[model samples]
Target chain A: MHLMDTEPLTKLDPSYSTVMRIEGVLALIPLLIAGIALYVAAEVPAWVPGIALAIAALVLVFYLPMKRYRSRGYHISDDRLRVVKGVMFHADTVVPFSRVQHLDVEQNPLERMFGIARLILHTAGTHNASVTLPGLAHDNAITMREAIRAHVKRESL
Target chain B: MHEWLRVNPLSMAVQMLRTLGSAIVPAAFVIFGAGTQDSEKFAEIAPWIIPVLVVIIGVNLLGAWLGWVRLRYRVGEADVRVEQGILSRQARSVPYERIQDVSLEQKLIPRLLGLVEVKFETGAGGKEELKLSYVSEAEGEKLRETVRALVEGETAAPAVAAAGEAGEPAAEPTGETLFAMDTRRLFVFGLFNFSLVVFAVLIGALQQFEFLLPFDLWDYLADLFRQDTIAQAGDALAGYTLVAQIAAIAYAVVAVVVVGMASGVVRTFVQDWQFRLDRTAKGFRRRRGLLTRTDVVMPVHRVQALVLKTGIIRRRFGWYGLSFISLAQDAGSANHDVAPFAKMEEIAPIAREAGFTLPGESADWHRASADYYFDRAVLQALVPGAAAMAAIVLGYTLVGLLLAALAGVLVVGEYFLWRFVRHALDPQQVMSRVGWLAPRWQIANRVKLHSVEIAQGPLARRRGYCTLRFGLAGGRLSFRGLSLDDARAMRAAVLDSIAAVDFAHLPR
Candidate 1:
């Protein structure tokens, strides 16, 4: 089987990593509080919060979001849409336009502020039934959704 | 009917009965416990218990009543709409074209009341898309007919309906009988599908609830083998070391097999009593039951693939089970069994009827390389071997050794089984055959192909191989350890077929 590799993948909006980093930091807030409480109670060493901050700064602020953003990509062709993501375990799914049951573009508060939205593609099978591509420019998400909807309608005929 | 309708008033009674049935056991247990403790104390609490029971039943009945009152459904021109939920109203509209199946179920009470539960199945698995419980039988049938008509109209064009692919005049031939099983076949099928798991569960339940049983079953079983007999056997085996251990294991094996086969036969017979399949106007219809009859209609076009399975013992008898990987959800069942157990010859006609040929014993089957075989063997053994080593280090020497031995056996067994795991692609179909204990042949029509995927992990990339996965409407098939080039080619072929969706074989 020779797969045609002419189509190049379009990378997600660069600001996606910034959104991921901000979300990650928000998640680490509780951990930071716990570390501070332990130190204030004189139970944990002063280095505890220091270590926590360093680890959070390294992972949440840098490594994870950057690595994830770099790994995520998608390609939309005339007949199908391909989404590739996964840092450790890579998955490249190609959903044929005819098979798409529905498509949706959603924006959470954070994503709305970031000017990005998520595009979801629902297919027939239970396994990998829906593929979500996050961190697309809001306008791009709408365009992609419309393009997919139009393709689905034409192919369904 | 254009107007929105509620289920029959009998539904409230049905719901109440269901609630009562579940509450009966717990209520009885409480009363029994109190009585057993002290008759005088039980008498004092008995009066209070009556009111408590009444309140419990009242609350359940009220909930059911509210649910029934709130739930309303309408049969639209091309869609079925439902408005339900008391507190948070939910409205669902399902297009007739998306309805994969229509099943009519009847329990004793509902059947007696001339009521049926109609369930609409969409390919998406989880809950039934629509359920109308305790609807009048006639109304249920009418609704089913309407949905089925819409599905047929969408698929069957004027020209195609004139003469079906089978060359049958498509005026609906009074429902052609496809397969039916007799009592003898049912008994044999039960025997072949013998489940040791059920026997184990039975023994486990007996052990756990030994006190609950009226008679002391354990004591009775012990009485079957006298103390003297056991002592005598032990003495006789003392001369040969480990002989008694082997004898005990052999005895247990024989007992389990005997019980397993008996229970298996009973289970199969009860489940599939009077099993029958017939080709209906819109699709294949199946009706069977011992206690609660189920009528499941699987629309032809909705079937994603066909699966043929045969256990080691069943294979010896040249018998195989047939099931459809369809969008149709069979209420409580996973795979809708078309034929429980049939000889290869018997299954061929049914296969052809479904627009496919039976898996031939001799075929041009393609297999992965020897490296692929070795790769599986290594992967299967690696984790277990490592676990065994860790266990040995943690002072579980004997168990660790046993685990290591089991892992070795598995790797060797897999090496042999790998030879049978192969796939073949014909013009119209792609077949994947796999298994050691139970060989399963999954065949998908090219037209049903929904999508194609190629995944390569770091390990697979290093090995110069990748996995090719093909998606159908309700199922996914994966071919592992294929060379990168072959995986790409297969993916391309599958995608091409999906793009070139054949209109001639559209689901009808």
Candidate 2:
């Protein structure tokens, strides 16, 4: 498959950092559940703690991907938008600029602390089409939103 | 408040009596059954229980009366407001712009009582948007006409006058209009197959009572076959009895035909006594039913596809029922249910009026995509049916010969059904035809398409084929039996169409 070229168009910084917090919280629940299960099982071997520590260490390793996700960026071009993110599997999804239905800049408590935001772009599809570009300065997110909205209007018509 | 428009005060009392009467039959049965099981226990409590039951009925009637008193509605310049609820105190206001459809219904008693129920459908979730249950038949018609006019962008001045007349302390529209079904068509529609009626009766019996009564029709038929006297007579006069039996069977068939026609006439009048379908600017308005009336309004644009069905019997008479699959907006309303509305061939004309072309009649229909005609029937339908039969046979540890025979028949039946899965895809449209005995063709425009999926299972992978399913806002279109390459090509074409076309520019 031929990959589309990525050209810098505009950047978005969504308002909310709660999404990142939600991700962290979701990851913690499963780890906690596993730890509780191990503790309750009477037949667990002596070396189980070591195994649990290894699993926790592996989970901690996932912090890198989460950080990369938090730092992931997106740019819209004249024809398409590119979302760049990866820990191992470097990926880019090219959404045609015409498909963009609406754009939303969201901010939550965590993003408020960092004075950053996230921008969400919605497209018309059965599954909600959205690209969340996080970790951007609030001012930059607003400017990027206006620039993209204008480009969408000009090019789509 | 207008003084002339009023619901009957006695209507509420009648409603309460009906509810009590329905409950009494089952309640009496339960009490009697329990008493029979424990006569001594019943004897101890009978005297006190009897008075308690009577008091309960009286209290129910009082509550119903209060409920009727508390319920009232008002019509404003741009909206309809209803105030209901005896204890919680709730009110609803539905604006004219948001109104999708309006329905009017009148029960047998209500019809005789000169009262009708009005329902307003909005694009909100499940059916409870707004309802006025006890308006006079004239008021109901006036309200329906007013709402219909408002939605269709007609002058609102007449509506204001109608509302004034309704609120006035005077009776109006004493001329009752009764809509009747064509008797010949009604018999044709009902007599072909009693499956639906039988199914409905069975469900009603099951839900209303747990045990099937010995007097049940199916039980009676079973007893007739089980009688030893009939079996002996059959054995004694084999040839002569056979001729007599054939003559008896013919007579029975004629009787059944007559009974079926009678049942049809009764059903037609009961279900569609005041049946009406009105065209409005927004969409179609439908209302029918006697005791528990229903009203539904479906917006024109919201309709995804139209399906026309005809059973073998109906087909012989050139009559078919038309139903549209639409996005559900109300829970308690008929529009939200899985079953579609039953209307005669007249639906096609209405659909054309509402800006939709009947499927087969469309000049835009091109040859279906090449994938629809492939030999995947064995994989898609036959294998699954056979596997199911196999599982059942093995689970029961049935004899191998018997299992083989059953599985063979199932596989054959599946293949026959699968033969009907034909489809066609175009740049701007997609059409599919399915069903064996009652074939149905669906055509949906690409502009209305919501999503597309390309699926390949394990077997599909080996066969180098896949299925492409097109999802519309209101329904779905699935075309199986395509080569993987062809499926991918179709998907790309659809995506390109979506990207290039402006849906708003499409012809409405």
Candidate 3:
């Protein structure tokens, strides 16, 4: 199946900028070491490591946009909850409402700062599998959670 | 209380000898070095050192005497009480219901002295229930019978009395065969344990090297084997002719078999020396040992799952070890551990005797379709394996870059194939089978499952697949390779089964 065709319509909330900053801060130590070594070592060829560090920094800079593009809004159909996620490798996962074993709503410090949340939907599988929707507006995440829970209960009966 | 029932009084002498052997080595070294270097210094300290050594030896002798005096045990109604320890004074009581299993042991020394030690396996939470250090063979048997009767009487009386009072027909307790092992079978079973050969070879090699500091002629023999000169001479002889080659091979095989036989004899004597298992109304009773005897009783209902394990070689011989996983009396540390219940050629009959229906034996087993998704997931899992393979190959072949690259590719390919073959799961009623070479099988009831989870990663989402994990009360089970729809379906099926189980009707 073509992945792009099944991509979810909903975009990640703009609050993912806070997540990008947290990731950047965590990445700062190695970035600083690379920058200092590049500046101080005149006898050594600096351009190689300098270019590598620059590429990594650039990747981190686009983290929020990439996450926003990949996060999918979920919808409950008659028998299943359809999830669409992924940007470069756009994909869809459809978990039947009756099969949902449990649901979790998590808020990390970065997400909490921006009033954003992550919704995890769990099913019974060998490896504990969950579909995480990151950078969702808190209210929307809660609403989506309740809707999934209600749908599961109704279908299970 | 009877004189014949007592252990040999000479057991104390053996203990004293052991204590002296332990103390003499260090003391001798200290005295020898000090005495040779400084006569005056040694003379000044000899009086103090000798008295201290005498006191230590005296204390050991006294301790052995007290152990003989205070080590009294009695099989009472509903429990076994053991009074032991000389200085602090200690008593242990184990209720009949709490006793998990019993073991009988006979150490070489004790056997030579015609004494046996009886040990009781209580529930996981307590220290070993009881240990009867020195008892005659016949007395030990009588004690085992009396305890078995008391346990059965205590549990049976309550049920019968209640039935009588209610004017209901008493349920007939079925007579079950408890222990079954012939000497020929034990010999076959012992022979098949290859671990004994490996252990013996390892011990022999270690002894031959003098790596552990030999104290006597044993060390001299070890040095001879370890000498490079001897090894060179042997190698020269080995290269000379076909006869030498044949002799070397024969010698190696004989060495291994001799070690294996020694190990087998020791294991058989210790584990099944005077093995006895009795069936009572409450549960099965097992007793075995040569020197240190042990007795264990396990109620039939408490047995949660029975497992039969066979290795590649053992499978050829049609031999397997039978073990059980039972509910944890305590929810803490001892969770999900297997207790060996029995070993027999066919586990089904033993399981039936233990009051449980064994799953049907079907070689035509189908992998849960979810296994395919889990299998495909291995490609993604190979990332780490590939990285490790790359590092090792690169690290070793830095001098020859082309060779390193070729090795790296081969390693990665091997890992990919191994991972692909190892990633399937089969869910069963009592147990789930997983793993590859050293297979791990886990078993529990659906009613014991506490939670379930379904998860999907970015790659898995692309494939429309998710994993389903069933978290039981004590442990967990997982199914991979399921489409989202299938995962959900499996989850509902598991939950429904869990809800339908009426635990109250299960034998308790």
Q: Which candidate comes out best when scored by TM-score?
A: 1
Return the lDDT, model 3, position A55: 73
Regions of candidate 1 where Cα sits further than 4 Å from its true position: A1-3, A24-31, A34-52, A154-157, B1-100, B108-115, B120-129, B132-143, B150-173, B196-252, B330-335, B359-364, B369-373, B383-404, B502-508
Q: What CAPRI class is candidate 1?
A: acceptable
Best by lDDT: 1
Q: For candidate 1, list the clashing residue pairs, or say none.
A: A1-B488, A1-B489, A2-B489, B301-B507
Query: Candidate 3 — which residues are off by over 4 angstroms?
Result: A1-157, B1-50, B58-175, B196-232, B235-239, B275-284, B329-346, B353-356, B361-364, B368-444, B453-469, B472-490, B501-507
The fnat score for candidate 2 comes to 0.07
Q: For model 3, how does the per-residue alpha-carbon lDDT over B1-508 read when each residue is reduced to its tens digit?
A: 2122334466686667767877887677667767876799999998899689889899999989987786666676657877778777788888886654454556666667666666665545445446776676666666665665455455556655654565632332334555556667666656665345567667787666433232455667778888877899878876779987888789989987877876776677556655555565556655565555545455666655554565656555555556554543332332221222244434556566655454433522224344343444455445645565566676844444554455456555445433532222124343445544434444445544434556666666666766566643223556554556655655555555544433333445
Per-residue alpha-carbon lDDT of candidate 2 for residues B1-508, written as tens digits (9 for 90 to 100) = 3222335576786677678887777768767766876789888878877797888788878888888888777767678888878899998888887776666656667767777777786745455668777777767777876676665443234544654565731222322221224445444444553433644786787766754232455566678888866787677647566788788779878876676666766765555545656554345656656565766656566666666666765555565656666654344323432123344445556657545565554444333233333344334555545655676667844554455565566556556655555665665566677766776777666655644555555555555666666655445566665665555555555555654654343333
Query: What is the overall TM-score of model 1 with all chains considered together?
Result: 0.78
Best by DockQ: 1
Q: What does candidate 1's lDDT look like per residue over B171-239, in tens digits?
A: 345587889889999888888766778857878988875665546687887876765777787677776
When summed lDDT is taken over every stretch of 10 residues in candidate 1 chain A, the lowest stretch is: A148-157
| TM-score, every prediction | 0.78, 0.64, 0.55
* Fnat: each model in turn: 0.53, 0.07, 0.02
- Candidate 2: C-alpha lDDT: 0.59
